[model samples]
Target: MRPAAWLTWGALAFFMLNLAALVGAVLVNSFSTRWFGTWWPEGFTAAWYAEAWREYDLFDVLLVTLQVSLAVVVISVLIGVPTAYALARRNFPGKKLLSLLFLLPILMPPMTYGIPLATVLYKFHLAGSTAGVIVANLVPAVPFVVLTMTPFIEQIDTKIEAAARMCGARTSAVFLRVLAPLLVPGILAASILVLVRTVGMFELTFLTAGPDSQTLVVSLFYSVSAAGIRAQQTVDAMAVIYTASMLVLLVIALRFVNPTQLVTRLKDPAQ
Candidate 1:
């Protein structure tokens, strides 16, 4: 191989090693009793997990996270799929500009729009609640759904819908019976991606959520930075739990959705 190729591979390997080491350290520390100056902790214990579960009120936090994620997924799918159908079936003036407008929310950083969005929610007395967090998350999620589903809808033949119409099918029936069955793969992919994004989203949720509305990620942030004396192990344990939850969700999602196929559909809409 060329020297540059060797150098590139060497750098990639070094980056992977560092990432693995950092994750490994956190995983180990989550279970460690103490390690002031040693290669490893003198002992291991699972008590930190319990302490974190209690101190962090992880059950409630996780419940809120689940609720927020699920609500975003359902609402985004309902709103975005129909909007995508319209764009797919119709050619209208300013369609290109409208699509670009949809793309902006997904392309821009959450913090960029989150402040204004939060301001709007607060003005309407919706901020600092579960509904507010859901609405904030939906801004990016719905657009993501539209973009992901648009290609899938485009790949579908219009003749199928025409045929359904010929069979005396109403517009609603055409969508429910004909288009929906074929769009399952796209819907599942978009839903899972949205769910993951909601779980990880911090800025929007943080800006909109109250004490009772806080999700797992927000609670984790507070555990790390909020003023108080807390055990490092407890915080590490919470991190582990967060990581494990995401991994488990991904694993389950992958069981049904082929990520490579999803990416291919997103990248090559004509396909």
Candidate 2:
């Protein structure tokens, strides 16, 4: 093997090692009966796993997480798909500005936008409610949906749409029956990205959701910082479960849309 390739492989090995270390810490903490820094827990137990779920209503929190994530996915797709099609298919005045406007939220730090969004939701009596959280979360998600889907839409040929239109297909029909299925890979990729973002979003949820409206991420945050040590360990156990679920979702999503294509193109670096 070439020296450069060997170096690259070594770097990848180091990265995987660090990742393993971080994950190992989480697992140990989650399963540790009393890991008080005496060089590993004197004994490990499944007590934390049972305690976390049985005591804290883990399934309820997961329900909230799934509901919010699904809502965000549906609403974002409905709004974003058409806009992505327009952006990919047409040109108009202020197009650049309009595109930038959609992208600004993702570019700006969360704190910058959250304050104003909170105030708006409060005025509308939506704060701390599911609607409030969903809308606030949409600020970033819609832009991401557009960005991720636009490239796939662009990859499609305009001639196909033109033919459909000539064959007595309405614009909506062309979109529904013609362009929609073709964009499945893009939609799948976009859905997974947005769902992950929604599941992990805390800043917007913290500002917008109330006690019952709080997301799993917010619950985890409070569990870690506000609750004491046992609660912390229990939270780690819950996090372990959540991480496993995320991995499952990724695996399921990748089965439909290749993540390598969804993420970045793998290339020969030396080329």
Candidate 3:
């Protein structure tokens, strides 16, 4: 085979190998009754999952995780679309500054925003609520959505919008009928990116999420923290389930948006 093909195959093999190893490690720990210094599990069992399902509140945390992630998706799309349009289509005073401002959360450390954001949320009585989580989460998501959607909006022919206006298509109608269909790819890309990020978020949720609103990651952290190595196997089981769920979501999201279009959305504006 050609050198490029050989390299591609080599890289893919390396990745799959690592992925398999990781899966095996988690699986062995999760399914084994005892995992010490041994190279392999002495026996396999479903007790961890059984305990988790029958006794633990993993399902509650999972539900909260779903709620927050979905809220982030909706909030990101609502807020990001207009900002993306403005950034992509117009050149105004402080345009660069405005762009940078939207990006502050993405560039800044979670602690930087989380500290002050928590205080503010407390003042508003939303500190431990879903709305608070959505607001804090938007720090990462809005910028991501804007960044994803900008390129797609730029690629769309502006003259089509202008012509639609000339033909008596109001601004709302143009966006609703003409631009909306073209945005499907970018929207899906942004939604998936936002969903994955929101689901995996730890620090912000760790700090702000109340017991009633704790996400899976935060709950898992507490579970592992409280139980120590004895719980490692169970934690591994939960991680495996979480990873599998995310993988399924990513596959479904991929089916909605092609890699080419997703890449196009992330490309440099001039390209």
Candidate 4:
């Protein structure tokens, strides 16, 4: 191999090694009983997992996580799909500017808008509630669904919809029978992306979540810092569970969605 190529490969390997070592250490520590000043634990135990689940009230946390994630997905999709269809099919003035506006939320860091958005939610008495979390998450999620579904809608031939209309199909009938079936793959992909994003979203969720409305990610943060002399293993166990949940969602997402295609769509929306 060329010298530069060898150096690139070496750098990649080093980064992968560090990442693997970090995850491996966490996994081991989560299962270990005792490991003070030791290379490994004196004993291994699964009890910490149970303890973390009960002490953290993770069952309720997971439930909240699911409820919030699903709500965000449903709402984002409903609001996004029609908007995407309009943007994809119509040629209105300032369309590019509107598209760029949609891109802004995704392009900017959540922290940039999260504070102001949270303030607005709180002003409306929605903050520290499940509705607030959903609304906060929806800020970015709706745009994401728009960007994701836009390409899918565009790739679809408009002639098909026209032909359906030519068959005397009503607007709702064409959308429900023809467009929706054709859009299934795109809808599924967008929904899965929204699901994963909402599940793992920390900044917005953290800013808006309350005691009863906490998602798994918010609850995990509390487990780390909520004024306690808690067992490290228990915290590690919770982290493991959080990691596992994200990984499962990612795996399911990858099964149906092509990352390369999504990236291409994002980079070249005109296509």
Candidate 5:
């Protein structure tokens, strides 16, 4: 291989090795019973997993995570689909500017705007609540759905809709019977992506979440740093659970959506 190509491969391999080693160490530590100045633990045990689950109140955390994630997905999709249809079909003044506005949340880091957004939510007495988390997550998610679905909507021929109208179909009937089926793949892809994003979202969730409204990510953070002297094994076990949950969601998402296609759709919406 060329010198530059060889260097690139070497760097990639080094990065992958470091990542794998870190993950492997965490996995082992989570299952180990004791390890102090040793290469490995003196004994192995599965009890830490159970201890972490109970002590962290992870069942409730997981429940809150699901509730918040599902709410965000439903609300983002409802607001996004019709908005995407309008943007795809209509030509209005300031359309490009409006689209740029939509892109702002996704383009900027959450920390940049999250504090101000959280302040607004708190001002309205919504912060530290489930509704606040959903609203905070939606700031980016709605735009994501719009961007992802617009290309799908545009790729579809409008002539089909015109024909449906000619057949005496009402607008709602045409949308439900004709457009929805064709849009299913796009909708499913967007919803799953949003679901994963919301579940893994840390900044916004951390800023808005309260004791009762904490998601798994927020709960995991607390497990590591909340006051008392806790077992490192327990914290590692929670980390493993969080990683496993995200991996499962991503796997399910990849089963239905091609990442390359999703990327292409976003980059070249005209296509």
Candidate 6:
């Protein structure tokens, strides 16, 4: 193998080693009873997980996270898929500019726009609420759906639509019968990505969510950052829970959508 290839493998190994160590440390700490200047804790226990769940009201937070994620996924798909179809098929003037605008949210840091977005939501009395959290997440999520689905839409032959039209099918029927089935993979891919993104989204959720609307990630942030004499083990337990949830979600999503292939197609739609 080439020296460059060896270096790339070495770097990836080093990164993964560190990542595993960090996550392992957190996992151990979450289950640890006590540790001071030792490689291992004095005892192992599951008490911290129970404590964190009860103390943080994790059930409600997880429910809120689920609600916000599903809402964002559904809304983003409903709005984005059609917009993606239009962008994929049309050749209007300013189309490039419009596409660029959609890319901005995904490319830019959420903090840059989240504050103003929260402010606007506040004016409409949507901020600090579950609906506000959904809307704030949608700002970036809809664009992501648009970008992910656009490539899928572009890959389909226009002649398929024409054939359906020639068969006396209405536009809606053509879309439902022809395009929708073909676009299933793209829709699933986009929805799963958006759902994951929304669940893990912190800045926008933090900026917009209220007590009742805080998602798991935002709630975790508060638990870590809040001033108190909270147990470190409990916090670690919370982190572990959040990590486990994400892993489960990814596993379920990947069962239906191959992320590697999805990304490859997005990068080179002509394939």
lDDT of 1 by residue, 42-125 (tens): 999999999999998999999999999999999999999999988887999999888888888988999999999999999999
Report how far residue 156 has shifted in candidate 3, in Å.
Answer: 0.4
Instruction: Name every residue pair that clashes in candidate 4.
Output: none
lDDT of 4: 0.92
Error of 5 at 231 (Å): 0.8
Which scores higher on lDDT, 3 or 4? Answer: 4
Most lDDT-accurate candidate: 4
Which tens-of-lDDT digit does each residue in 176-224 have in candidate 6? 9999999997898789989888998989999999999999998999898
Give all TM-scores, in the order shown. Answer: 0.94, 0.88, 0.87, 0.96, 0.95, 0.93
lDDT: worst 10-residue window of model 4: 262-271
Q: Distance (Å) between predicted and true CA of 114, model 4?
A: 1.0
Runs off by more than 4 Å, candidate 4: 268-271
| Clash pairs, model 5 backbone | none
Question: Residue by residue across 98-139, what tens digits does model 3's lDDT show?
Answer: 877776777788988898889988888887877788788888
How much lDDT does each candidate structure score?
A: 0.92, 0.83, 0.83, 0.92, 0.92, 0.91
Relative to the true structure, candidate 3 reaches a TM of 0.87
**Which residue runs does candidate 5 get wrong by more than 4 Å?**
1-4, 268-271
lDDT of residue 171 for candidate 4: 96
Give the candidates in order of TM-score, highest first.
4, 5, 1, 6, 2, 3
| Most TM-score-accurate candidate | 4
**Least well predicted 10-residue stretch by lDDT in candidate 1:** 262-271
lDDT (10s digit) by residue, model 4, range 1-271: 9999999999999999999999988899899988788888899999999999999899999999999999999999999999999999999999989998998899889998999999999999999999999999999999999999987898899899899999999999999999999999999999999999999999999999889999988888888896368888898999999999899999999999988977987995442
Count clashing residue pairs per candidate.
Answer: 0, 0, 0, 0, 0, 0
Which residue pairs overlap in candidate 1's backbone?
none
Question: Which regions of candidate 1 deviate over 4 angstroms?
Answer: 1-5, 256-264, 268-271
